[model samples]
Target: MMRRFLAILLAAAVLLPSCLRHRPGDSGEATQQKDTVLPLGFLTDAYQVDSSRVRDGETFSGLMNRLGMGARDAYTLVQRCDSIFDVRRMRAGNDVEAYYSADSSGRRLEYVVYHNDRIRSTVFQCRDSICGWVYSRPVQKVRKIADVTIHNSLWNDMIDAGASPLLIVDLADVYAWTVNFFGLQEGDRFRVVYNQTESDGEVIRIDGIDFALYNSGSFSASAIRFDQGDGGNKYWNEKGESMRKAFLKAPLQFTRISSRFTYHRKHPITGKVRPHTAVDYAAPTGTPVHSIGDGTVTLCGWDGSGGGNRIRIRHMNGYETCYMHLSKYASGIRQGSRVAQGQVIGYVGSTGHSTGPHLDFRVWKDGTPIDPLKMISPPSEPLRSENLDSLGKLYQAYLDTLSAR
Candidate 1:
């Protein structure tokens, strides 16, 4: 049932240049182009996002090593962006794309995580778009068509693929929301088919994610994330379901549930309050804790053994989630870090007022702590109705393809 639910909901492609032209120009060396690059082909080898690709649950450092994406690349992707679409959990049924390499490594250097909700798609080519009012007047369309095939390096693949400038802009806007663009591997993943400018082939963009799939666990769960409210990169399910919750599911996916929220219970340490304010998630010495929503970091730094590495975030709706007793925070969870929801702010450990390694998870409302597991969450952003003109047909076609299989 979950597989059917996921497969039906999400999906998303690429190509490059040098794949065009009738002849490879017989010029000895000055202008001789070898292989006649495909209309669009792989720049680097493709790898599914499974255990073979992940170095850590939160990060996929090992995939970088094999794909030739070193520490610098990995660090850049991890530090700047909190959560990246790591390929370690990618399933074999998913797509793995690769575009050409501008560098000598011959890797599909530029990669992005494309979710078909169930099957993780991998496409090679341009993902970045440059936006500027390209024309004098504005134009509208009912249906859009974009068929791109590219060859050359990954960077060039995107260029030759004729990707729209607006799509690139949209990609950048949500770079922090889903996957990390900076720390791409030799063979990462990407897939898109957006609206483009007709004359002069000047591309605009496909405003946002019509439908996308993110791979995880045994079978991938379908997810379609897009933005709304002016220019916020708010992601949602294909049916416009919001993935953002009032509080994160268990602080982090890997950490174990140490304790549940209780109104009246004996305190493990002092045996006084009989009121447990937070639930604890147990983990190793340096597990990172994340900010559950978009808010200002109110407190950070060490506070003693009971609260070793304590950090707090004051949220928009007077709601807040707290992580207590950490070996350390993730760089800057300081006094004023403006963080989005689901962003990593610190690691897990035994810090303040605790025993062993664990994260004391707490949620607050009206400036008071509340049970995180109880609140109802809002839905994710949905695609604009105007944008859905071409979506129905496109979705049906993809569904036909899936059903046939």
Candidate 2:
């Protein structure tokens, strides 16, 4: 069971440019075209641009010194970059651009641009004054389609389909409330239509998922993105029901269930038959453990009953949950502390029990220990009647777009 769950956890890729543009700007490339804006808002025709990567163990001050700037000017430039862009963040191997004056035998450097990442950069002026400011490339949203069949696991299959791992994470988040990802079987398949934020023809991040369908031979679940004047977007099914539930399906994102709840079970360490009510999730140590539902921490301390570090939370409707063998509690989490659903409350660890790193999770209903896998959670509010037609139209439009492929 744990191996299959691990296989499921270890699981995109077509590029379809969307019609939406995030901001007004062209690709920051040095071009001969008139008025062409290079990086840092400098016109390519106005200056000679030299691009290079930051050498290993090179500092901003050292770069300036190598560029012929005096020590005092480099020091002042470093000081001005404090609040704008910390010089310490100028990581090695990152791209850097130096702008030189057009008509100069001196070959003097006027502006230096350091790429913080692919999308963000910092421009440092070094001609006469020492100042710096941050700049971000204009991002554009591109709709992408990923249709994959589960051969081994979602992770490996999606990767084999040329999809980004980031997209897999997003898809997992979209179905966090409903899908039993740990129970994914062979031949299962899914299709998703999502948006990717792109800059300079490269994906910056996943904007969001618009539509998704998971087919497991016997059951099919569809998620459609819709908004009904809630000032935020949400996912719903074809019947106008919300996809979000009161609690998440699991406490951790990607891990295998090492143990199941059973009355007749043998303890691994003790080698004795006993009732094991908790579901054991086996993951690496320090993996974040999240609260399945919103609640207040009732008990956050060590357990002397061989459970090790434990946290107990009381929820609504006479429901309570316990997380055992935590390596440590999340910051600000203690007795009486309020926690939101899906919030990280602790991390997976092997603190007290005789086993490797894992989270021992248990749930109770009216003071009776229950199986968490069998627990059913209430769904969020459905779409209002007035908004059903709008959702239908939007969902159909997405379907048409997806079906075109």
The top-ranked prediction according to TM-score is 2
Q: How does model 2 score by TM-score?
A: 0.74
Model 2: residues with Cα > 4 Å off, grouped in runs = 1-73, 79-114, 123-139
lDDT score of residue 256 within candidate 2: 91
In candidate 1, stretches whose alpha carbon ends up further than 4 angstroms from where it belongs are 1-222, 225-235, 241-250, 270-273, 302-305, 379-381, 389-405
lDDT of 1 by residue, 1-405 (tens): 775443323210122121121221145631433332222222123222322222233334544445445566655544433332334554444333323234465444444333323212322122232000000112233233222232333355556555553454444333323432332344443444333333223333354444433232232223334445567535544444444444444555434566878978766788776677787777887766767677888888777646777888887767776788877877656898888777888888876677688888788888777776665444445566764544445555644543453
lDDT of 2: 0.81
RMSD of candidates 1 onward, in order: 17.5, 11.0
**Candidate 1 TM-score, true structure as reference:** 0.42
Q: Candidate 2, 325: how far from true, in Å?
A: 0.9
Score candidate 1 by lDDT: 0.49
